[model samples]
Structures are given as structure tokens and as C-alpha cells.
Target chain A: MKILVVDDEADIQPLFLQHFRKELRHHDFEFDFALSGEEALEYLKGNSLEVVLILSDINMPGMSGIDLLSKIRQDYNYLSPVVMMITAYGDEENYKQAMEKGADDFLTKPLDFNLLKEKLKKVMNNG
Target chain B: MNFDYILLLIVFSYLRRALQSKILLPKIDKYLAIGFWFSIVLLIAGFFLKFTKEINAWIAHAMLFTLIYFCLTQKEFKSVKSFIYSILPFVVVNFIEDCIELINSPFHDEWNNYFDTAIFFSIVWFFAMFFITRKQRKEMEKEQLKAIEFEKEFQQSEILKAKLETQVAERTAEILGQKEKLQKALDKLKTTQVQLIQSEKMASLGELTAGIAHEIQNPLNFVNNFSEVSSELLDEMNEEIVKGDFEEVKNIAIDLKKNLEKINFHGKRADSIVKGMLQHSRIGNNVKEPTNINKLADEYLRLAYHGFRAKDKSFNADLVTDFDENLPKINVLTQEIGRVLLNLFTNAFYATHQKQKKSGETYKPMVSVKTELKGKGIEITVKDNGIGIPEAIKDKIMQPFFTTKPTGEGTGLGLSLSYDIIVKAHGGTITIDSRENDYTVFTIFLPTE
Candidate 1:
């Protein structure tokens, strides 16, 4: 199974890689990285790639995470994929907006990787 | 014949009275009265002296001249001409008698004929005096009538002058009263304007808060989360050590070290956020004072609407203020908060104006401000019926420099700065609710304490 991560912050890459090292080694789960919402859309265009789960950051320079989530839902959510939004601040306003835009789930930074793992395990089981 | 002393005495007595009348009237303290009596006695002694007939006749003429002079002093006789006319009959009779005496060889012979001629002259003198006195009385009557007319005119003028003075005083007082009322109204207007300007300055703080929160909160989260996870990892390491898993312990040690590095990085990020927030807030430095929140909001609402009108002449809006009269006075930096209100009102006006342009004459641009007493504090809302923010960019609205307005019109830092003022400085919250084509409402909550 392949999980896609979209974020503007370069540091998030290393953090996630270290956090999911065990899962990457033991389970047959592959990870892909996209710097922005536009970049993620480009990667999704490939006919061979099967992106099952998408993790996106809400705030960015262009094509914010919320916009990316809406576009994914409108175009490809029926293809057995789940999208979860990440907000910098755990404000209820942003949380509600993400949910209204068809986000499956949302979390705040610095992300609790343990909780995220538990949720992902559920996604992995369903997929 | 007669000794003629009796006639001489009678004539002299009459002369003495006329001369006495020529002397000035005696003052109340008559110091010279004794001297006058003594002179009278000398005149009587001269009558007994047995002097020559010529001497007696000369003395008698002197007395007659003195009598004429006395008659001149009478109040009825004014100028020298009138005096001469008054004594003319007496003087003429005396002159005729003197001529007769000269013809009779001396004044002594004329004395024998004096009684009959004197009686004839006395009749003439009485007639002249009667006419002169009658004329004088007529002149006096005319003078009295003129004095009465002058008194009446003077009284009328005095009454007119008094009336005009009172009227002038009443008019002056009326003008002063009007001036005082006008000054009071002007003072009220100026105070309202000042409060509005203060709120305008604070509006920028909200946008600054949004930027600062996003930048710092994300890193702070990382620090907190990594620290908590590291502690949990230590317990896992303890469990592994009990099993004598040496390799697993080494991996856990490496993971803990990496977590500490991230904690350090995010900790520094949080520190910088605090520094930046302080720096930004300092720019809005103002001393707090007891403030009426309702008055502040209402004033800014009017000022903003007028400000928009000044920029675009065609722009107009129905501005409304619904203030809670029961709200208590709160301690606040009046100018800073006034600035925030000004910014919000200005944005509201701008939104309404833009909508008016799109919707034409049928659309009425409306902007309203409301202040209400809330839990231990106050709440203010600015609402506008105009162009609402699009949903896609709603989350970005509070971020610094994110504006839908064209360049030169909006810096887009207004909402962000207002957010900073309310949340960071005042321990308050700012929220927004909007529909795409309907309305935009910004609600602010402030704590009293």
C-alpha cells in the first residue's frame, strides 16, 4: 500500500521518515512525498501509481491543503483513497472547515504519530 | 410858609430806600449791617446841620442819582438801556426842575415851586413803571412755558434711552446662550471622532496575531509532542533492557537523541515566536484607561462610513449602531481598541461600497455595529451587507497580507492586527461568519478583568 504526504515544510519529510521507519521495514507500505498541492496533483496523474491514503498540510504558499483535499475528493475519492488534513493550530474553526470540505480526519502539529498510526492501521485494514 | 424840613425829610427818606435797594442783598450772616445803620444816621444828622441852601440842594441831587442807580439794580431792569428807560421819567422831571431853578436865579427859588411840579412828575413816573412791569411779567410768562416744554422733551428721551439699553442686553444674552449650545455640540463631535481614530490604529493588530500564532504554534506543538513521545520511548527502553535486548536498547537510545534535537529546534522556534509577538505588540503601545465600549464602537462606525464617503463620493451606506446601555465601563487602551474598531468599520464600509457598485441603485449598502454585555466582559460585532469572503480563501483571511482588495487599497493586515490585539494583548477572541453573496459579520469577545 502507498501513502502520499503533501506539505510545504521541507523538515516534515525527515520527521515522518524517522517516525515510520519500523512500519516501512516490516510492513509492505511505501511512502511518496509532494511539496505542494500542485505537486501532489501531478503525481496522482500517473496511471501506474496507486495512492491509497493522502496526508496533507493545510497552510502553504500556493494551492493550500484544503483546496487540495477538495480537488482530490471531487476527482478521485471514490477510487478507494482517504485524505486527512493537518493544521498548524488546533483551532476548532479550521477543524470544522476541513471536515466540511470532505476531509476524512484531521490532526494538529506536532503530530502524535502514535495516534496517527492507530488511525492508519484502521485505514490499512479497510483498504 | 413852611420850614420845608418835613418835605425835605420825606424826599430824602424816599431817596435812601432806593439807594439801599442798589446795595447787594445781605447774606444770612450780615457782618456789614451795623456800618449801613451808621451811614443812615450820618444822612439824618446832615438834615439838622443848617447848611447853606446850595449845599442842601447838591446833597439832594446826589441822593437822587443814588436812587436811580438803585432802581437799575432791581431784578426787573436787565440791560443799561432798560435801566435808563425805567428811571427816565424821574430823571427828566429833575432836569426840568433844575433848568427852572437856573432861570429863577438859583435852586432855592425852585424849592418853593417843587411840591406842585413834583406831584405832576410823580404821576408820569407811575405810568412808565406800570408799563415796564407789565412787559416784564409777560416776558417771564413766556420763559416759564418754554422751560416746561424742554422738561417734557428731556423726560421722553431718557425713557427711550432706557428702553433701548434693556433691549440690547436681552439680545446679547440670547446670542451668548446660542453660542454655548453650539460649543457643546462641537465638543461632543470632536470626542467621538477622536475615539474612532484610536480604534482605526488597533485594527492592524489582529492580522499580526494570526501570523504570529501560525508561525509559533506549529513549532511549539512539535516540541510538546516530541517531548511526550520521548518519555514514552524511555519506558519502552526500560522494558527492552529487562529482556537483555542490547541491540534494541541502542536503537531506542539513538531515537531518543534525535527526538531531543527536534525538541531543541522547536523550542527555539517557540522562543522566537514569543519575541516576535512582543515586538509587534510594542508597536501598539498605549496606556489603558476606563473606557465605554459601546461609545467606542458607535463612533468608529460613523467615522468609517464618512471616511468611505470622503474617498468615493458616490458611496453611501445606512450605518446603524445597537449599543448595550447596561454594559459597565471596562479598562482598555482606548486608542488601540478604537483603532481596531475603525479598521473593522472601514473594511465593512468598503465591502458595502463594492457591493453597491455591483448591485446598482436597487441595492442599499448597510453597515451596522453592535456592542453587548457578555459573560464578565463585552462583545462587539461589525456586520455588512456586501461582498462576502469566498469560502476557499476564508481560512486565509486572517493571515498577514492576505487580501482580496486590489493593491493600494488594502494591505490586508487589518484583520490580522486586530486578531493580535484581541487575542494576544487583551485575552479575547475574534471570529467571523460569512456567506458568499450575502453578508460578513466579525464578532469580538473581550474580558472585563
Candidate 2:
């Protein structure tokens, strides 16, 4: 399985890498990182690999996660990727927007690895 | 004794007539004078005809009648006095005639017969004058009695006028006291209004502070996240450098490219928060511009709740959108409206979360935000199913510094500042409807044209 993670936070990638590397022994998964929405779009344009999961953070400086999600939905609404939104604040408006932008699930952070793993299992099955 | 009594009675009759003239017939001095002379003539005729008993008895009766008349007419005593003065000369002349008849009794024989006649005439004249004087004295007594009654009445009227004046003074004092109390109440009301205004101003400042903290914190989180990643990349690079592994260093260098890009990403975020703050706090400059409300509301609502989430990772609300495609843009301050939306969404979350915390009643609270075109205006509604507002506190919630939230969680100016932004600043309206434990909806209307 291949996953694309779009976040402005550099620390988030390592956190994911550490958690995923410890959990998955099959070595069947590959990970890609984009620091911003524009970079994420650029990376999508360059890559031909089929990505199954996309985890994104909504707030960023320019071309926010919502905008990126909107663009992604516009381009590939039919793609059955399990897109999960990771955020620090647990407000309804953002959750609603993320879903409207074609996000499949939502997770709030202090980075619970166990919860993420459970959510990934469900999302992978669904995908 | 009979002649003396007759004279006294006649004299009293004349006095009564004189007093009556003075009191009742004051305007008819001529008639009073004629009547006095006529009485004197009757006295003289009585002596000549030898009718002393008849004349004396009639005079005695007339005297009593005159006294009664004088008593009745004594109310006009001043006029009666003038009439009596006018008859004074005639009374003296009659007295002189009486004296002459009395003195001629000294001659004897032929004079003795004359002397006897003159003595009777003299006695009749003297009695008539005596009766007039007695009547005058009684009339004077009657006049004095009337004067006493008038004096008593005058004193009573004076007392009444004095009492009325005192009452007027008391009423004036009472009215002045009431006016003073009203003025004091008015002063207290003015002070209370001023305090309310002052506290409202302070609350706005507090909201601005909290908003700044919240906005800036988003970028700070990014900074913290990015910095940790960059430090890890550097640590890996250092390990590759110490081992003198050029091929691994090249791969790490390529890996560091994405982490370096994150520095730019997080830096720009911090800049935007500062910029939003600058725009939000700019005062006294009218920067109202035409803005699409639907776009603004959707964007800010998302941003306001950008990082919020549920504890159960599976739960998510169904979002329904109903944007009016025909709605025209309106002149507005975008950042102000953004702040207003932020406050509203924050309140919605607070309400819904509280409901979720309550035992046995944890129905997944739904928040609906809708926009509609309403006759040259736009109506936006933010509705939530949560612990709703109470009727008693509904009106007070719009007042500044009034909060239902726990301490440190609320500044209480959220709705009030939102009220000011929509209604006072934009010339729009904000209305709230809520039922306990059912739903709370805030509707805002802004003119499109």
C-alpha cells in the first residue's frame, strides 16, 4: 500500500514514519510527503503510483488543506482513496468542510498512534 | 309723676326717631327734620286741647316702636348718625320755645291763666326733646352691637386666608421634594448607563486579545511541528557526515528537501496570522468593500474550526449547503464578519460539546449553517442542537459582559461584539431563538443592496 501525507509540519512525517515502521512488518507500503498544498498538487502531477490513503492537515499558509481537498475532489472524485483529516482543534465546521471536500474520516491530534492504526485498518478495508 | 313719665316717653320717642333717621333714612334728612317738627307741634296742640293722658300714652307706645326700628336698622349706623346731625338745629329751637313757656308763669291774674297754659306747653316740649335724646341713645347701643358681630366675621375670614396661604406653601415644598427625588433617580440611571458602556469597551479589547492568541497559535503549532522534523533531519545528516558515507548523505540530502520546504510553509502561516490581526484591529478607517457573503462565511467558518474534532474518531456531522446563487455581494468589512462567524461557531461547539458531556442524553448534536436570499437582503442562520438558552437569560445574553460559560472559558463579549458588528456597525440585525435542551439559532440579516 502507498500513502500520501500532506502537512506543513515536518515533524508529522517522522512521527508517522516511526509509528508505521514499528507496526507494519510486511514492507508492502511506501510513503510520500508534501509540505504544502501546492507542493502536494505538484507531487500528485509528477507521480504515476497509485496511492491508497491520504492524510492531511487543514490549516496552512497559502492553498490550505480545504482548498487542496477541493482541487483533489475536482480532479479525482471517483478515486476511492481513504482521505483522513488530522487536526488539533475539534470543531464541527472544519469536520463538515473536510467531509464536503471528499475526506472519508477525521482524527484530532496529540498523535494517538493506536487510534490512527485502528482508523487505518478500517479505511484500508473500505478502500 | 304722670306728666314726668309722659315727657320722658315723648323725649324717648324723639330720640328713637332721630336714631332711626340716622340709621335707616340717612338719605332723607329733610323728612327726618319735618317729622321732628311735626311731633313738636302735636305736643303743643296736646297742651292746648287738654289731652295730656292720650298724648303721653301714644308717645310712650311710639317710643318703644322707634327703639325696635332703630335696633333693626342699626347695621347702617354711620348713615343714621348723619341724619341725627341734620336734625340737631331743630331740636335746639324746640328747646328754646319750651324755656320761654316755662319762664312766663311769673305773671298773676290775667297772666296767671297764661302762665298755667305755658307751664303745660313747656312740660310737653321738654318731654318731646327728652324722648328724642333717649331714642338716639338706644339706637347708638344697637349700632355698637352690630359693629361687634362684623368684627368677629372679619377676623374669621382673615384666619381662613392665612390657612390657605400656608397650605399653598406646603404644596410647593412637597412638589420640590418630589422633583429632587426624580432628579436623583435620573442621575443614578445615567451613571449605570455609563458604566455599561465602559465595560462593553473593555470586553471588546478582551475579545481581540483572545482572538489574537487563537489565530497566532495555529501558526505556532506549525512552527513546533516543522522544527521537530527539521531537527530530526539534521541529526540524520550529522550521522551520515560522521560515517563519511557520501551515497547515504546524497539520499538524506534529497530527503531534507521536503523538510526545508516546510520551513517556508510554516513561516508564511505565521505571517498571515499577524496580517489578519493587523487587519482586524485597524480602527477609524472606513474600509467597507463589496464582498461575497457565502464565500466569506464558508471560508471563515472552516478556518475558525480548522483544528477541532470529536473524541470518537468515527463521528462526523452531515454538512448541508444551500447558497443562493442569485444573491448579490454587499458592502462589508470582511475581517469583522470573519470574527463574528468565529464567535458564532465557537459558541456552537461549546453548546454541542456540553450536551455530549451530559449523561444519557448524548445524541450527536447537529449544527446547521445556512444562507438565504431574503428580499434585497441576505439572512444567515447558525443553528445548533445542544443545551439551549433559557428564556429568562436570552435578552441579557446580548448585553456585554454577561456570560453563561464557566470562568476562563468565556469573556462574554462574543455575542455582544457580534451584535455590535452586525447591527450597530453594519446597520443589520441579529436575533436569537432558543428552547431549553432543544436548539439555539442565531439569525443575521444584512442588506444586499
User: What DockQ values do the models have?
Assistant: 0.20, 0.07
Please report how far candidate 1 places residue B394 from its true position, in Å: 26
Model 1: per-residue lDDT, tens digit, B268-373?
Answer: 8778556634533454456777988987676455445544544543354666778899989898877667767877887887787788779886787788888899
Alpha-carbon local distance difference test for all models:
0.70, 0.66
Against the true structure, what is every candidate's RMSD?
Answer: 15.6, 12.6
Q: Name the weakest run of 10 consecutive residues (lDDT summed) in model 1 chain B.
A: B1-10
Q: Tell me each candidate's TM-score.
A: 0.47, 0.46
For candidate 2, write residues B358-403 as lDDT tens digits. Answer: 8343366566678888987889898887799999998899887799
Top candidate (DockQ)? 1
What shift in Å separates residue B141 of candidate 2 from its native position after superposition? 11
